[model samples]
Target: MSAKKNDDRKSVVVVGGGAAGVNIARPLSFKLDATKYALVLINPRPFRVLLPATLRMVVSDADNLGTTALVPYDKIFHAENGTFLQDSVRSIQEKSLTLGSGQEVPYDILILASGLSWTDPIAFPDSAEDTKAYLVRNHEKFAQAGSYLLAGGGAVGCELAGELKDIWPEKEVTIMHKQRLLFNDTYTDRYRRSAANHLTARGVTLHLDDTVEGLPAEAGPATVLTKGGLKLSADLVLKTTGPTHPNTDFIPSFDADALTPAGFVKVKPTLQLLNHPNIFAAGDIIEWNEQKQAIKAGAHAKLVVQNVLGYISGNGSSLKTYKTGFEAILVTNGKRGGISYFGVLWGLIFGGWFTALLKSKSLLVPMFRKESGLV
Candidate 1:
């Protein structure tokens, strides 16, 4: 809401070209005075990834799903619109960024949305080509597998089981979790029951309260041992377990106290770093007390952009504060079925074709394409 002086341009650098960076940079590019502010987006990947669609890509036999999820950076940003640096951040100085390519980037304001890491074969690839290759490799493995075991009953695990079952109905698919609920300590009891019922209807075996002890070190199909003394064999076993690593190691000089024990950067309600006001954070890298969903990240990006403008223009009051809102989750079962839970006390659940129409049909790929300016 604040305007900067047009005499000298200010550099605003955004590290990580995911949802947070793109949402922040793209909107600010049109809102901010081009002559007085420059927006620079830095990410290792050549394209912005729509992470939600990854589960479908892994389970389906199609190759186009993964390709459609990766939107090119050139389509989103340009030299005139903003600077897009296709490189990783080696380290972060007070007001500068050191890229892996040995390039130094200075900025008056910085937004860190570098994201986090998940287990292999499920995590996003490094580049567009890598994404394609990853999808191809995993699709082949899935197609050839007789039995699939999904470790963890989170959204990813549930959706994966459903997709696998939908694609190969005769194939054996099981979801293993250490807890009773499908969502496992995240959602309410109602949501948990609903998810369990949906998966049950889809013929996805649920091994609740079961822990996977280990898998063989062999390269091919092998037996999996469970801590509960259960042994199961699967042609493919994918672990979507918790304990994700944050991508904040690049900021070695950052105040350790400003980071959570889990390593996520802690920020004020205004989305600025607590210790360093000039630095902001959003997306999976933030320590926000909310589900790390793309919708939430996009909302966070807007607040970060507003705060960054206020911080650089010397109008601190112009910065807006973020408030946690109604929690919601959309769990898609496949092309024709899914579930959506919104709110807490008065939460509403939607299933069947309604949920499929909302997500499963195309996994919102068209929405992402338009969001990244690909259209």
Candidate 2:
């Protein structure tokens, strides 16, 4: 703990401990020379959810899920070698980090792999009418949980409606798709037909090609009033919307303003920020024009770590570019299934049971354990 002892070791600070941060750190922690590199992790959550598997948890499948996903930091990164402080990061310098607790950490290299926060109706109250009355919890607020009005109608929304129908037959589930249906990628008519038929048959209402304009009181408690004067009752307004970076508001050193027009970090081909080669980023935070994937995020982290290692080895930090390729797992739960689009090969396993089991089965406990060095 002495200053002299600390000064003798090189340090690498990583912000965010979710998928990208954990995966990157786990591999590098094992590869780096113990005496040469030190990892300092800053995060707020005690548990990182295995997001793809959360559908099962929504239905209260906590027993098996307890072991499938969720890794405690102590188990994942252990033996008193690395450090984990349960604090959110505020901002980052080239080689330093300012945490919420006012502690400043310096690193030889830095990985800004923080993830994004999902936007719900309440999060942007000004956009909709009476959205406040809908969402209950600040974190898990869903207006449709006990009522009838649904928010989004994409993959998350669609799957959730199906699950609710399966579990609670009498309860009404409404899905508001912004487009016709799962328009992110094209699916064969058979896939849509099977899914639509199954959901409709189960009493789940599919409202496609509609956007929520506002929520009024009369349309209260599961019913939402849209811009087109259409009123629908919904119990829970869940959001399966994608993610964007969090914590960018605090970055001061670089032209943090260069973050994309939509508020994401702009990185070069090598995955380093548009500026500040001393720092790099990955995961949902990076503004890449493509679908977000864990494998790509991991690969970006690897490249960043490699460049960091090169700098340490006195080999000159010339980094290799990070390229994104397609990789997907086909998810089929209930009756219908769609192929997840990976670049070269697409894997298929469909249905709600399989869909939930595909990614959500692991509570991420073991993965965290392995990442944290518990194994």
Candidate 3:
């Protein structure tokens, strides 16, 4: 089922409708000359899931945050400039994509924003209804559990611990991380310690420099052994160890060398694929030396859009290069407060009042909704 080419216009196809994919496609749809270029965004879901607020959604569904997180793609693009196909890519060819529906969509320029995969609560199902159900189930689990064990102290794990403690303060919540800090080494030691202290102040237990082992498959009552010779018991065990891998299995079929050993795409500073100048890679899939955050992915999208526009307008020499900006992170602990870090002037760390006003209070859901044309 090969899609007919749009007359003489060339297609600029974007894969995955996550943060990077949608950001790239949204700008391209409005900025591109509709007569000369056709924009296509391919994603498996009809709605985009706002991942940052999912931890709070799992613990509590206040203000219907779970439903608000999943924004529909119907208003993202106009028909004259762009087409949104809710389908997954089965394989990638040199000039076209073979979708799961057996349709082949050709492209003159390609952008791969296919993000990585993560465990549930952070990752949701395809449809909006199913995703709501999934959130409800998790919320119920959290409500019923007397003890919660989070098996990774990354952003997700720490934020989740905060959420659980905020909601059920008496319930035992513990985080077992392999690393010595709450977050990775990208942040300052003082900032990391502050995060740990905030959680500890809320009576959340921290098992730093330890790893959980021998956990059952299901999320029920279980006693788990740790690598640090400690036995822990919990009513529910959740693993938020970060991304499993980038969604780049289809890229190997097109150009094997375009991928790195870790399955991330190799790209030039201009955000173009190493082996294919006509293709671009961004977001978590790109092999960039930085923390994989929404801010970083949004920056990648902006750069890719600029570079792609330049390439298509025959001004490739003037294309902009993507430089990793300073490190800025906002880690929320429930709806009341959290921690924030800015890499300016050595480092600037903010506590609950500032964090709450900036993000934790509303989780930036309103901003995302307005951006998605839902407001």
- For TM-score, the strongest prediction is 3
Which 10-residue window in model 2 sums to the lowest lDDT?
122-131
lDDT per residue as tens, model 2, 1-375: 211235667877778787788877766776777776787776766655555544443444335443354445765553556777777767665556777777777777777776767444313221112222222233143323554445665555655565455556677777666766653554444455556665677777777767776544222354456665677655455544444345466654456575866667888887776666667788878888665655566677778777767666767546677776654434333223222323342333255455444433343345445655655
Candidate lDDT scores, in order, read 0.80, 0.59, 0.87
lDDT-based ranking, best first?
A: 3, 1, 2
Choose 2 or 3, whichever is better by TM-score: 3
Q: Which stretches of candidate 3 lie above 4 Å from their native place?
A: 1-3, 78-80
Compute the lDDT of residue 252 as modeled in candidate 2: 47
lDDT of 3: 0.87
Candidate 1 lDDT, 258-360, residue by residue in tens: 6778888888888888888888899988887788888988899888877877777799888899998888988889878889988777678888778899988
Better of 2 and 3 by lDDT: 3
Would you give me the overall lDDT of model 1? 0.80
Candidate 2, residue 209: lDDT:
68
Range of the 10 consecutive residues with the lowest summed lDDT in candidate 3? 366-375
